[model samples]
Target: MSAYAIARLRPFAEPGEDVFTYIERFQSTLDPFGGRFLVHGGQLDEVEGSWPGYAVVIVFPDRATAHAWYQSDAYQELVPLRTRTIEGEVIIVDGVAEDYDPAGMAVRMRAASAGAV
Candidate 1:
């Protein structure tokens, strides 16, 4: 199983706080946990619905790994910084694949999501 953490963020009231700095620090903190940053803040050219100010996705080996990272002391400490800098949603999704086809499944998912299938 693969787990993903999806975060949608908004700017905080404090000008001193920012996600870039927090992510930089958090990246180090998460290094020992076997977590990988799949997506961080980048240019957003499309707006289909209510888009957050920032969005991120982190991938982990499993659900336990993702949950442990979130509850870990290191992350717990950094959470306040994230809280100060953003206001939005966070989600953890675990994908269970018995016979996964990375490329084929991804294409199908994209097509389905885009209403092209």
Candidate 2:
């Protein structure tokens, strides 16, 4: 399954050298893992509750690849520079298959809940 490394970052101050450096070097970290940016903190039009900051989404070949990229030495080396200027949340999630059905998942969940009772 395809997986994503998503982040919601809010800046503490005006973007500085560290922020620029992180952006410049980000692609190299993803190169070895076959990761690509689907959304790189671009402009967003909000219609819901709230999204107070920039949203970043990087898609990888699979969950394991996503995890590998996150834990790799190259990315870890840039963590400090990224964290120094921005603050927010990051998560990894697998994308659903093309033919996935929510009803089937719900049925399985209900059965599991019933079994637990």
Estimate, for each residue in 1-117, the C-alpha lDDT of model 1 and write its tens digit.
Answer: 889999987755664646566767887767877888888877666557767477789989898989999999988888887776567798999976878778997898988999963
Model 2: ten consecutive residues of lowest lDDT: 10-19
Model 1: what TM-score? 0.72
Best by TM-score: 2
Q: Cα lDDT of model 2 overall?
A: 0.93
Task: Candidate 1: list runs displaced more than 4 Å.
Answer: 12-21, 96-117
What range of 10 consecutive residues in model 1 has the weakest lDDT sum? 11-20
Q: Provide the RMSD of all predictions against the true structure, rounded to 1 decimal.
A: 6.2, 1.4
Q: Score candidate 2 by TM-score against the native.
A: 0.91
Q: Judged by lDDT, which candidate is best?
A: 2
lDDT of 2 by residue, 1-117 (tens): 899999999856788899899889999999999999999878988899888889999999999999999999999999999898899999999999999999999999999999999
Superposed Cα deviation of residue 3, candidate 1 (Å): 0.3
